[model samples]
Target: MEVETINVQEAILLESTTLSSRQKNEMNVMKTKYGKTMENSDYLEKLEFFVIDVIKTKQMDTLLTLNRTDGNVPRWFVTGFIRMPGFLYAICQLPRRYRYTNCINLFIDSCEILGMICDDVAGSRLSKVDFNTQSDEHWTLFVQFIGVIYREGNSAGFKTKLIRTLRLINYREGEYTSFVQALFKAHSRIVVLRIDFEYQKGIARTVSLSEALDDLDHLVANMRNNAMFDHMLGYIFKVEYGVDRGIHIHSVLFFNGARRNGANHIGHAKQIGDYWQNKITLGRGTYWNVNAKIEQYRQKGICGIGPIHWQEYDLQVNLLNMVIHYVCKEQQMIRSDAEPYRKIIRKQHFPKINEVRRGRPRTIMIASVSDQLEVESI
Candidate 1:
């Protein structure tokens, strides 16, 4: 299988529109108040529509459409690092209330709108879940939306003139600070790498535990050297759920490179697997789907979340942040020095461990052996 380079530039930004019903309503309210309010009403209206409503609606639509589950991620619902001080900054600066019902309503409405458009475009009824389950594709779309929002929020247009009156919540207290923090601490860097693997004709195609471990070790070692060479503190480790079976890794490294100054080397990183895979191999008579690589881990069964278990995902996300932080600090990077990427380095959290288990085993034994390295940079 040949891995194609992911063009970050190929990211598609949804058309920016100023025609939201919510925005129009707010405009009328402002006009009724005789424009006497001290609030930066126009700016507030845009932020609410663009960032809060649009992003949330897109995410909710994907989740509901794919999972067929129907609980809203309320503005007040802190999804991990999003709860930190940074989120507070966002809320206060935008003055967007984290109302539960209103947020859900907006999400459902967005889904309906998308559904209507999709139905018309395809000339068929839009089924919530297709027979093959395109959940992964939907997830990719959601991630793209995230990328777009990040791009816009970080743009000079939104930051300079229009939002001058806005005092964004400090990165420490932003709405999604926990998630941001979990991902971007001064010391920890999220490294995503992609690798292509070719199987020896029909042999079971999968990576073994030792291979996964070796790849992780190599990445960490290089990360350490990079940090040391630059005379910066470095911490490095591969994050994984060590289940004594086949393994997957989420490696985080702290490097003291010039990245702290303002270089954006972040994304689905490609360097890790590039060194391992030489010439790309094309599959004969068959092609590989990108999503299969992400879901190849053999697992028996995992139970659903109980009431208490519901928070486990959040806990896991938080733990990941701590682990990355600890590793980076161990390597000598100071958290205080990460001011440049503060907003980009979100403090997000996952659910707790016990909450994730919810009493079901998530293990499936696979005796089959294949020769493919199913890895991607996250």
Candidate 2:
């Protein structure tokens, strides 16, 4: 069935006289599949030239044009002409920071168009090789890479290469290799913690989430300067449990003196239970439950400190998920060679992942249209 076109393509036609050879081929290919015609060759020619001009400008207009095509444009054509060109252009034209930022924008746009962008796509993008970085842009890349990967027909080997590159980028800083080192070096740590006392709980009906977060933030900041904390853990997080969740925290303690048999001791991680019980109550405010449940707890002493193992606890992982289990959060780094505590480093190569399908009828028409136009004029 014929679908209405978006006006952006019409704007392309109005601003130019004819389609480029490349656009003509694309148009023909699109037309043939639908058993339709780029019936208005004059308009098609103009639109083709317009697309070329936009692509040449490196303005990321391919996205605008592609989106404007409505349902008339098939996936194949969009992938090849629009997405590929825009992706490559952004990669080439933008600075490393801007390129990453724009890539994220494009991925987000695609997600909004496609519905429910998955984490796998973010993972795949993050795994892409860093063009010129000493260390992988792990966080930035992961945000976009996974979305690209989840899009149908992406190559696994390509993703693997990208991920491998990211690993190298992550290792650029030699001094701050482990969490222990990071704790010692404040500059290398990215996150801060906070703790605050509810000056007036039990008097107020409820405490705002913002207030709780502020309290946590205050606690995190105050704990950073603790002599024992600073001595053992440089950048380690100091958590304060509020009366909300039973007043305990899932915390990591840096035990610099902890001993390691084969390798150097990393540090001891622990959870202080019933954190609320230790808090100095404010005048009057109602605090929500923020305490996590504790089950089996064990500690194996390594150096001087212990790596305490608890059954499970919930911690915030990202901006989206408010509550995430400690197990899943920790396990995410299981395959990651970048973790501070990892000892066994194994490299496994997986097979290449993409498989292309035969061209559909619509594909031929678009290709034909794209070919007939003068690519330079467009």
Candidate 3:
């Protein structure tokens, strides 16, 4: 069966069409065979944007020209290429009736071409086989190429390693939850605010990466002195980079809920953002108040913002799983261990809780009599 080559928009529209009875039956059969359908819509959507960007910008040739000798390849390019196989597998798992055939074919073709380039660079016959027929061998070569790119220090290995560590923590279900739980233990309720700090348009290009990082550090240092954050309990910040935004920080601020009682989180976020723009960056920076889009997140059923009580288990889970992951997703992917990037920053010390006696204290005479009686029995 031949698959038609169509634009992403057209393919998406086709995918949305109501399925016929036969198509539905086939989809059911596929689901049963695959054990369970993989719900990777988010990943697939991002992959779609990547595909469109590569095709529209004609970056395929530059991506295919993998030079083993030249050490100038962009880290983003290598990481993005290495992620193609995973994307391909995601597409393949979709039922045939709803799959974007054109996108899958493009990935398959690119993988083959890039695999051949890897073979040439490695001076091996690893890429001589076809991925469609011999997927095991293809995957073996792909894993080998990962080591090749990691040694060159232009791959996603470091970021992947960090994410894996995070995943391990998340799996244990303690680290992030414990942090939040400790905050709640000290305070009756805590307000969570997410703020993104970025440079103004074209301003990032003017300043060097190190300068941008220094500015963030200074801003965070001054946050303690800022009147707005006087009641702040804790904070977490992650650094990331992009072509347009350059270097930026995604920060989550935890405030004493009692102190911020009846306060508008969105307005508070805006005030902090304005301070970052007007004071810290001196009019050269801007910010996004994530709390401003609270309604949208609520609509998406992933609402993890606003004030939360200690008993709000579901909201805490969302904050730990979704909010934290989103903040840490793109952090510190451009650098390596030699000049380590400060990917995440947090408070050095947490608030200590003083132990208080739960019941009335006994008099000194009574306490001494009880101790003497116990010693005599022994």
Candidate 4:
């Protein structure tokens, strides 16, 4: 039962040549139950080094060198194009807009060799994915869905940590797009707003993360309860950092005022700014900017205006969806006890909602060579 090797490991421990106690136990069990194809001691060490080296480096030659007789380990390996390293490179190495369909073709062309490269090399296995999830436009989506489940040997804490780290690294565009699409799909009329932080009379205040958070909290409460948006339908907020201007909050408000095509009082940027500024103050002399915008969904494009609105070219870009994507995008910030820290202020929206419409869920605990069918001849 040689499943096609994907080349990515279940966890970082796979990045090492030595097996954890859990992996050692799994191999021992597999040997007793399924019988060993090769000895575990020296050969398994070689296989471990091979997997770590190949996946991290994404070397084809390294992959070609793998052999069951040499590593003396079970044949489970990285599933599908997960081995090429190049396809996975876009996660961090390649341009955000970069797409290489030829890379998938390359994997298809070499699948047989890749299929022959590993023989019974397992410490982990991939879980089956529902084929319906595959998109005809993005074939790799299905292949990438399968993941190496590091058998019952890895501790729960260890697996949890690995999954957490991967969420920040793996395929995420689908998650972002899906959530954004779902929000605006229900409410097409949107407002994109930004609140900037200004020092009091040009004096920088002590802006700690908690203080900034407090400012955002107060702002959201006033916006929803204020006489201005009292007739509003729904709203959301996001916090982002400025390289020199400091921390600010971004929001998209979906109101019932689309009936006037944005001619109403809430549609005016100046009024929204004035009222928004009065609610949240950063102490002595400090203030927030009322950068607000109104957009309409017409002609399959978003029509809007603001100080920064001229640069927006795509009318199809939903301001609400854009705001949702901006806020929901992956962020990595560790704790800091100092003022002016790079922390995102908005907590996950109350009543967490993840309405994914593409790809797989963030977690997959268990995958096959037979699962590696080309949807179309490459």
Best by lDDT: 3
| Candidate 3 worst ten-residue window by lDDT | 369-378
Predictions in order: lDDT: 0.28, 0.28, 0.54, 0.35
lDDT per residue as tens, model 4, 172-254: 33343343344333333434334344434332323444555676666667764566555344444554433123344555444
Give the candidate order by descending TM-score: 3, 4, 2, 1
Which predicted model would earn the best TM-score?
A: 3
Q: Give per-residue lDDT, candidate 3, residue 72.
A: 43
Task: Name the 10 consecutive residues with the lowest summed lDDT in model 2.
Answer: 311-320
Q: What is the lDDT of residue 288 in candidate 3?
A: 88
TM-score of candidate 2 on Cα atoms, chains taken together: 0.24
TM, every model: 0.21, 0.24, 0.52, 0.37
Cα deviation at 149, candidate 3, in Å, is 7.6
Q: Compared with the true structure, what per-residue lDDT tens digits does model 2 show for residues 1-378?
A: 432333434434442346577665644444233333232323322333333333233323333333343434322232233223223222221112111211233343343343333233222222122221111342233223333433421346534644553443233212112222223222211121221123342332144333444545544455545432443333222122222221222333333333212122221111111232243123232222221111111121111122211111111112002221121121101111233232211111111112232343111101111122221100
RMSD of 3: 16.8
C-alpha RMSD values across all candidates: 24.7, 24.4, 16.8, 20.6
Residue 113 lDDT in model 3?
50
Better of 1 and 4 by lDDT: 4
User: On a 0 to 100 scale, what is the lDDT of residue 79 in model 1?
Assistant: 23
